[model samples]
Target: MNKQDRLNIDTKCINNNSLNSSQEIQEFLEGYEGYQHLFLIGFESDIGAQNCESRTGQELGPNNFRALIEQLQFPSSNSFYDVDLSSLKLAIKDCGNIKPVISDIEATHQKLESFIKQIRELSKDSIIVVIGGTDDLNYPALCGQSAYSEKLNLIRIDPSLDFEDKYRKQFDDLEPQFLEHHQSHFKMTLGNEIILEKLGEVLFYGIQGFKIDQDHLDQIQTKLGGKFQYIYFDRDIRKTMFDIQNQEQNQCKASNILMENRILKESQQIELIVNIDLTSIKAQNAPGVSEPCPAFGFNTQEIEDIAFNIGKQENLRIFTISEYNPAIEKFQTGNVLCSIYQHLLLGIGERLKNQGQVIVANEYEDIGQQELEQDYFMQQAGEHLQLQNFDFDPSLQDFK
Candidate 1:
């Protein structure tokens, strides 16, 4: 296998040729409007159980999982998004007009490229929400043709940065592999074409990290013009707060870490691709991740608070939650799955036109939209607006 390459993910657990309707999942995939949203999960790792290892995290198995997909469909409207995908040969049969396209192939690189191609072919405007086997999938997931990718943005919510250096030994030395790797064995993906490219296609990538990657930081800096983002959950924030407080001289480090994400958000108009990993939450609260890092994920209240902020961002192109596995050992994992689903589901609901009324604004002109320092927030959410918020409070003393 290539360095960054592995076998396509194994998804043999998916037995149905179609989705089974249920209540919970239906709510999760709630706001599809004929536009497609693909949820690719990295269930093969620490989160992906060999035989249901530790079922303490989130689980959206085929049953409720189908409901999640269905919820993404139009509210009996927005007909353009309703694509009949039975022909795609996915493990699930009835994924609504949307089918459950799993990348269970042994060739991970092949699967990744194939899935991206399939998504591009299925619909030009579809949204791919990959649940993810690992964080590495983000770049290859964008391997579809570049013009199509120009419309794509990445949004990742995890506590750690998937630094290129972190997993150097995982496969071959893959940093250089993408430039030299190509395969043509996928017969069942979207467009049925074999193509390859590295990183030119994506618009913007949004990553929320707790323990970030230096390479990722570098990319965020150089690629994003020094605006890669990371969101520390309350606990991680508190932890950083404590660490900084305990430090003798470098006291500003703690304050900088705490304010890093918002500061990045404040500086630039981030056209986004939203990728969320539940590991950003407390592992005790969410345990089914492939890798349960100590400093990731949000508290119960933090989920929606962050999602609300994300939903409020205008430049968001795609929103994905990675690391959900249901066929594991415990049941709490399933509960967390339900909770996180509900969180993103609520975010989608907020954006959906069918779920009653959407409070669309030119920009947040309300006084409440102003920063803590009393600066106003500019137009943000979905790409039409250059999301700029004028936050003048450099010091907490300003707010005090």
Candidate 2:
């Protein structure tokens, strides 16, 4: 990495009018530059079949990846943004400084364990951006920091809920069909990578149309308590026809989304993730995948806007982006990739708040002066206490 490669978004952007983020957001990004807070992590399995399907070509290879890193443009970001380049390269360069660290999990189970451990150790409350070999990887990343299995707010904004116990649908379409229907309930299916511990743990937004089975519904309602929230948007079916209220309250305002039957009733906080699978975009923008769907605006810029807002919230602890198929859309892929990077970068700028260090300037003098002050106070307190015999009873309040 060169001097030009790093991006301290918070410190640099304080004066810029272009990227207006809140103070809370400014603090998040300021401290985020610490090694403990930034990770450009990639994950893939080495099973011959799975590896070929998931990891083989999906990586931010050295050259192109470096280019992206070298191009990040934050306010007064050490002068590199001034370097000359065409609009395209300049745009590609805007992705925040993403340090590439690919985790290619070989067939061995130990490798997975090692990868997870290293990531947790390295992440000191910093953001871990993993290039997913499959959507399933989110489970481990989230669990790595879970507090005794207690649920935190986790949100998955994909077109569909790609929640499967097994990868294969028993040589059947039930799973594939389910995948399609799930998309109808979502804007797209970028991160079908979900576990069914609780439908409440996940929230599906941008859903359009869905053909959910009764059994699935029962499972969610009975077993999972229908705790998750789903903002289903059948765009082609309804096509978000109203913008009359440009006063759009939120992304969910655009479509006729179905909220979870019971989760809303209970009303608890959720963990949120916003995933965008490539094929969700127009086949022309991002093509070829195990599953394909035709729907525009699934990448609907609004989703990104929603993502920025969601990404900004103080409660959102983890942020993950997956399934960017470059092999499918070469020409446009860079821009899409750039957008993903920019969102995370700027979002990092928005969430990784760093309270500038508090330098206690009068170190020696301050410490000596403080000790003298403490002695004077202690002596005065001793005299005051000598006048009375009293028992401290603060802790006994609870007993009473």
Candidate 3:
């Protein structure tokens, strides 16, 4: 199929000058040279969710996300990260939704892969933000990025392990019953040997103990070895936040510190693909998902912080959010998801601000050699402790 037939643009959300007082993100240009561009692409399908016996409203996630994003006003010139927003020269384009080939999952993935490759060809440095369908979209997104990058790092923010043992076989070779039970991550990573070879430093954050099976965890550990690491939602994440709350009087600053120390690291220069599943968020904050986590998950602020941190990575290529079900939404999940996109833009703006700047010798010399050494040591110590603490078993708790 042609590009026009495979994609559906939503005209209602694009440059509608109805609201004159404030500027919405939708007003940004479809194309602009010499600017840091952000492309918004949507995948409209829930067939993968249906196959996995999950809820079915995720097909509408992209449209709902765009609707809420249209209602949010873009950051003013003086309001962005304490820096002049105009200097960033950011451009946002809504590329519209990919017309899903409902008859076959492989066909839909091929279309998505082709679309992403085209975007990469157009602007090699542009950031791509993919919304909805299911986490299954991650497979195609990775396939597209692989065309440009050989070494890829993936960070999955999800509660469940999403490992289907049957996905180890080729998509065409899988039996009907096995195909029906496949999840995104395992199918994309463990199932495909090509992807596993290129993958580097996979991190699973916000993991819930009860949602995953012990056998899958064992297999992941055995296969990936030291490269695979995870942080539990209940044990590590919440406990760290509770500790921060007790130590720091300011809640906002505390959250910032938590994200910076735990997730964001300046030393990470490798290319990254961040996949976020809405089910990783707390049900109270994001109840609309293929599968809701009523008892454990990241809060709204925490997830937003994570999005912002992920955006700041200099080599971040693709950012995807999946499994958002608007059918059961309580009118809050859409707004929360919008905020995550907005924060990601702000973080991108911060990255742009740091690019192409000339640093003088005097400015560099201001930092004492002693202070530099201390900072390096502190970072090394923190990394060591983080890895050491990751050796715990997730099956210890029965949160499910």
Candidate 4:
């Protein structure tokens, strides 16, 4: 693909400077060496479908999401004055979309992995946000971690566990492995012994019990043993607004507590990759996903809260939003998608301020050599430790 063909967010969204010259988010687009917190990339590929029956049109997800970001209004100081939204915006560099070789998915995965490695080499601290065509895109995101070799705390916010007992065979056959919620590439990537050997921890959150294959989860849990954490699904989260009034307790708060504790502390830079499938949400809120379910999933606010919480982490190396299909609900899904992305920025900005690292426009573009060296050191140290293949202690499962 030619460089010109690669799509990115239009500059119009960031160019709004009605307040002042320095106030606009666009003023902060410092080339590579700056205070940028995110590198927005897209993976526009949907070749992983098992058949035409499962779903299509997810390939349009990235561009649709970009359009939503462009159309939405930016937040004001009244909403998030503590965080430097302008600086955060300046730090972002949309690298454009990666068009996978649809005929050969293996080649597509390799191309994506290579691209992610190049980005990691450019900046370790910057979060990589990969807008995906489908859930299979998560595999490439996970594989991208190999570039840093950092111990990862993979957090999957989905309605059901995507674990397959015979994942190895499915992968070998190159079948449409991730067509359904039950059979997903995540199963092969996260449940694989080879993959787990390199991971520090894996946690599954917001799972729906009825949708999952209990036997498959059991087998994966046994394999992962202490390396995994499962936050079981409770029916209360699926209650409608009216039903919530009758409920005795707030289910969201309970889940939030777990999310709050899991935020990677600055002291231990455990690499975080959040894979959020739009299907994880209630059908009413995300009807455009590849496979929407009316029966089980979190409400809009709950998923947004979860996304915001994940975005707030200092060690969030990668964040992927997948399976959004504009073909389903068109504008309705588009608006929901925009809200999710906007809230994520707010959360990240708040955390940056709390960490006492509020980025100024000028400070973003002119990063010093000392700062570069520190980032490099951290990346190297993480790679070295990953090579050691250290076993995660069972005590790390405190969230359980």
Candidate 5:
């Protein structure tokens, strides 16, 4: 890949013959109208990863993952008629990659911020799945989300917490950091006063204790109090798995760690971003990340359950998969990531289907129309029109 090459939407992706109806995500090929639950966006810059001197080839992540997705078969809606994926009318689109200005990484993030803001404005209900160049990309991703929601709940699944207190010093310092070294999302977000103030809650799962300073973690925990909730380390997760695997009888009940959390329940009512760092997985399952500590991560099944359950939430706005290095793993990691995608899509589709609402393209259109109508009605009603003019009881306002 050319380092200074400007990013552009690869129209070749939409025209590819590999994406046939029987195989691949058919909805992606059907124009923007068919997309519902998920919209995948790619980024071609691995600048962030390179800054950390961790690895390169993250720029190739989107293309490699897309190539894999194109060959995989879509779930048969007919076979699972009971859940009725057909009725749910799920759609997923490849919105193409965010191309940055020629040789400008900050400009690239600016473009991403604009793209995310546009997507949020266009369709707040649709869930966006960002295929990132690195975890640092999460900064711009959430910046766009901040445009719409004042406060957001972040659910981050990573083996390591990316918080550098020095990076949080000044907003102007970010561009230099982005250019120089790999910046952590935690540091970047906190670095910006706007994002920090807007962060209502945070949950860190599958964290690698060895990668972070315990004092820094405790300081953040104490600062946020209830908002900084639920830290599940790799060891705790392994313990759960150990217990489940050891149980010969009544094993099914013990294996219900996916959707059984209080923090997850609260996350459903607000704007939530589910970020999965592929490095959080064991090296055996995912060797494609920029930084991989072989035996120090979650297994495939554990990651899948976490993703699936998080995907099931109704208010999930964005799902990001980051730190994937295609050149490092040589396509082996895509298989596991693909399976996780399957679980996530199925969980999301089932949730919408069970709720008896297929919220996608047309639903957004209806919302737009309703808002327009409400605006017109409000204008005609007049804001200054008093309750006494309509003979309203004064006591009614005080009832609540």
Candidate 6:
């Protein structure tokens, strides 16, 4: 198919309505009046995995995730966390899948980049969640966001670093058959100077040290300079989690590894993009990826925590979950992904609530003393009280 034809949204999964009357999320789909808080788009392509000679079937990731998520039921008010979810009124829109050109990888990237640019321009305030076919799609996602942002920061959660230096003699000597597919997986790395120029800081989280070549690591370090930081699977992640636990108990200062890495700092002003490769999780937890880490990786809960923390960042612009292959999946990976998405949404809700409070406080500060007459003050107080009583739709107030 031509590029324009490929840009059409696949709505098969979206039109499949839930049968349960009590379904909370299904009610928020696409017909809301105000701004949508979340926009879900799928990049449907396994050509990257095919080119890289890894297992294919990630092309089905988006629809598979949707089929499972549609079955979920929101917790009732009497449950453990007894908050009234119906009152939140969050809206989510599934824009459906972007069909990819199998024969031309570059064309696929171009189509995705253009489509993402449109989404960003159309709804600058919305959280854009991309369901990916493979990690290579991350390159286009980053490019699309950088078009509108002056400075960008990236956090890549993966088991092995995907950097491969083309200039190295070892790389130059490789056979053409091996070389073509090998380079398909390296687009997200710093091998491209254009991508490097747009990035202000980058963190390679959940990296397995043994899986990386020493030369590739050294090469990335040299190119990235002080802008690069990494958290190792064996050495650092566990300790970071321990530090976070201690901080929560008030036994130590409030510091997190992400905070130390500078990605989660609320004061930072850069637009952030997070790319999560499912293979970063242990094989037992996420066996449905192109490449599974059998020996060591993050557990499901740890990955959920990471997602929530990343979501809470005020500057998070785009979040991509990639490398999910349903062909080899053992039935649990889809559920794990759905849980991660829910946690991320919760984090976003918390951020919005905090910002709403600040906005209310600022309005109070802006009131002039002369205007605070007895009757006027009472009227103003009543309005503020009414604001508290109003149905809280986090998307109603523009945080931008």
lDDT of 1 at 136: 37
Candidate 3 pairs with clashing backbones = none
TM-score of 2: 0.53
C-alpha-based local distance difference test score of model 1: 0.38
Report model 3's TM-score to 2 decimal places. Answer: 0.74
Q: How far out, in Å, is residue 7 in model 1?
A: 36
Every model's Cα RMSD, please? 19.4, 16.8, 17.5, 13.3, 14.9, 13.7
Residue runs of model 4 more than 4 Å from their true location after superposition: 1-34, 50-52, 74-84, 87-90, 165-182, 190-194, 235-255, 260-268, 359-400
Give the poorly placed runs of model 5, Cα more than 4 Å off: 1-37, 74-87, 101-103, 165-181, 241-255, 357-400
lDDT of 3 by residue, 1-400 (tens): 2212111122333332121111223233332345676778788878787666667878888878877765654332326365444344565667667767765777777777887887776566678889987888888888888787777788888887778644334557655544533274465566577778888878788789988788888889998998888878788777776777788853543235435543346326667888888888889899887678889887887887777777778788899988888888835888888878877876776776778422234433432343355459869987998988866343441110
Error of 6 at 349 (Å): 1.2
Every candidate's lDDT: 0.38, 0.39, 0.68, 0.63, 0.65, 0.65
Q: Would you give me the overall lDDT of model 5?
A: 0.65
lDDT of 2 by residue, 1-400 (tens): 2223222222232222222122323334443323224434444321212422343333332223334433544221212222211101111111122121233232222333244444444333444454543444455455444422244445555555553222323344454312211122221222323434422344555543452344543444554444555555554313443442344643443322322223222333544334555444444444533344565435544434444444344344456555554444433544554455555444334443332222133433443464466559868887887878666453432101
lDDT of 4 by residue, 1-400 (tens): 2211111122332222111121222333333344544767677777664333457777777777777766664332225335446544325555566676745666766666766776666566778888877677778778877557647778787776666433222545676343322245766675556567778777777677777787878877877777676665464343433355468444444345445444343324777788887887889888987778887777777776776777677777888887788767767776777777766776876776666655454543344443456459869987988999887553442111
- TM match of model 6 to true structure: 0.73
Q: What is the TM-score of each candidate against the true structure?
A: 0.48, 0.53, 0.74, 0.73, 0.74, 0.73
After TM-score superposition, the amount by which residue 382's alpha carbon in candidate 4 deviates from its true location, in angstroms, is 43
Instruction: Give the winner by TM-score: 1 or 5.
Output: 5
Which has the greatest TM-score?
Answer: 3
Better of 1 and 6 by lDDT: 6
